[model samples]
Target: MRADRLMTIMILLQNRGKMTAKELAEELEVSDRTILRDMDALSTAGIPVVSDRGKDGGWRLVDNFRSQLSGLTMDDLKSLFLFPSGKVLEDLGLHSGALDTRQKLLAAIPGTFRGEAEAIWERIHIDSSTWRASKENLDALKTVQQAVWESKKLTILYEQADGEQNERVVEPLGLVAKGDTWYLVAIRDSEFRNYRVSRIHKAIVENETFIRPANFILAGYWEQSKEEFIQRLPAYDVQVEIHPSVMKRLYFTSKFVQVIKKESSSPDQWIEATLRFNAEQEAVEYIVGFANKMKIIAPKDLKSKVVSLANSVIDFYNEL
Candidate 1:
């Protein structure tokens, strides 16, 4: 552990040129005495660590000192160019630094791999936002980001689906940006829950702090939650007879429906297919779009609803 601290101190001195013992201690979450000992260790190990004593004095690496990461290969250098989505970076207030960080990384690569590594940027770009997604109001984003970084608790006013407002004090863990939307994953009452960033009417960083769970990984936990949520959803199957021409339009018509099985009765004229929906009303609404091009084959109740809805539409159109 001390070896790691010594190496980290050396790297910091090399990059920062100069830093006070107190500053290093704060950055490493240690005491000033430990930092002084680490400095002595680095100097004893043949590193040129210069320490000054005065009003404007601190530790610094001797002039002409250069320490580069020798283990980096061409692929490693290229991977450094990979960055998160721009919207996410902007929310975290790192958009400006992202570009500067990439360029500085390019300058750090050895000449042998520099050209090939820089070519990655010229060839690749990542766009995570969906086309024409409405921009979310992220006024609370910066406050929530700071809380996550500082491991501070947050008292937030959240809007619920029933139009009721609830205030919760959550331990801010991580943020996930999908398309133009942001989801705040946090711990409340010792349970992990997700809150939409846009739905947060107010966010106040509390003075309290929370010990982050040692094994709670943001990416892994979010994925597991998604899988569990999907598994818990009730799925119903619908049997339908669809004309061959109408099947192509089914894909774009419903987001919740998908064909599970198909049987060809007349060898390409009509297809009997089983589709999945979350509810019976969903099935009825989707079936109504096809009109006479499709017919319900089973679930007599759903068929009756479709007929009733169709007749209602006919009556409404007749009055016009």
Candidate 2:
């Protein structure tokens, strides 16, 4: 990167008190003339660096010259370290600032709980693969989250997969972020609709805000939605001859009906597990994900559907 040497110089100066031109050149593997030129550029940029001539001479940024980023508590800094921002701030080719900001951030925090913080940092990693990217709509997201907190009306443009876009005034209800994807559960036309943040092209905060009803919550609505789905979809009881050795693990998941039982002592380590799904298609799709691990026993339709899906996937990949 064009500024690689310059950044190196800045970091070194930030860490070490001061250094002579020769030291900078040797540390950065560059000639004295190159270092001198960089120092000129750096000085011109008002980098709070001073050079002394006679004996006690070297270039140095005024000690603690950089202002602290204030108000962030130790916990806050640690949290940021544990979960760095998703976006790449600058292209490495352009700015190439190394010394991960996260490391510097952690270093600045008080050392009292640094050990605990380190443990937490190692254990807790945010996949945020589902969090909406870009600051493009952050103000809107914050406004909507606030509205959800306050039960206020929000105007937003929602885009469908088919490329259709519609602008509507709706009430913000709650939010859920799955992986990096964020969803806003809101009331539209007296009905709850899940709006994917990425699909929302625009949001306008209305003059009106609201106080959210104490009775409302997104999770409660979601649980109700699951129950409703079960009622809506055709109920189909399924018994699968799952591999016996996995019975304990299968029971732990409880992905199936509570009515689980082993059919017989099998020569092969396998067990018969009974589960139920609202829709045959759903069950079929579910089992297909674990193709070799599961075998549908009683319901021929589920097995056939799984097989059909597998065949279709195989055919598609084979053609590719």
Candidate 3:
């Protein structure tokens, strides 16, 4: 806990500059004395962390002091790496070699997180298929990511979803993945765009340079295209309560529900709550089949729809 607290303090200072004992104590849930002691430890470790006492300031970093800027830390990699799932992907297809992903990532992580990172790498398995990238695409994703970091321009062979291909010079944004796909999020000719990494034939960094816009955030680009997914479900939110016994199995499964506002939860230690069916007729039919354990809830119209559908099914079967 102390080590974690110490790491927390460093990160806090790294993000917020500095803070008084009162602030750190309250935020970290430790006493003032403890905060002071932790500060002493940080200083002894030569963290360049500075503290000041004044009416105008609680604490602040030394002026113009800067730590080296790097890529993702051990924690960052761990979060991105995704466990158990990593183990699965090792067999599927994931690549990050000439991507120079490791060195850059190592540089980003703080010296403190190095150990935890090593342990995680040893324990976690990211199953990925052997990258089948033609030298061109393999080169393109690598170039695009590098250029984004270096602030440069890129000429890449990109194929759109409609099967169109062209060599376009674009400024890079970032990379994102969904299910088995990876995309290069970028700006081409002043327009924002996303290029699936698989379709890129080749990428070359042009000698030219480009200014990264002051107002750009990657998160804005990567959210799932909900409109595309919602088309698969019924008009309303379907509701189905699952039995508890199946909860653990469901929890262990990785669901890529492409588009669904379904849920599966342990209402107690014994019952699972699941909802999946947009149309009442469909939801009811699904709920009834699992009648021994599942229940339908909400949307009064759905109940009626389900009864009618069930009766119709019964009638059709009886006629047969």
* lDDT winner between candidates 2 and 3: 2
Cα RMSD, each candidate: 9.5, 9.9, 15.7
The model with the greatest TM-score is 1
Better of 1 and 2 by lDDT: 1
State TM-scores per candidate. 0.71, 0.44, 0.39
Better of 1 and 3 by TM-score: 1
Candidate numbers, best TM-score first, in rank order: 1, 2, 3
Model 1 lDDT on a 0 to 1 scale? 0.83
RMSD of 3: 15.7
Off by over 4 Å in 1: 1-79, 97-100, 110-112, 262-268
- lDDT value, residue 31 of candidate 1: 99
Which numbered prediction scores highest in lDDT against the true structure? 1
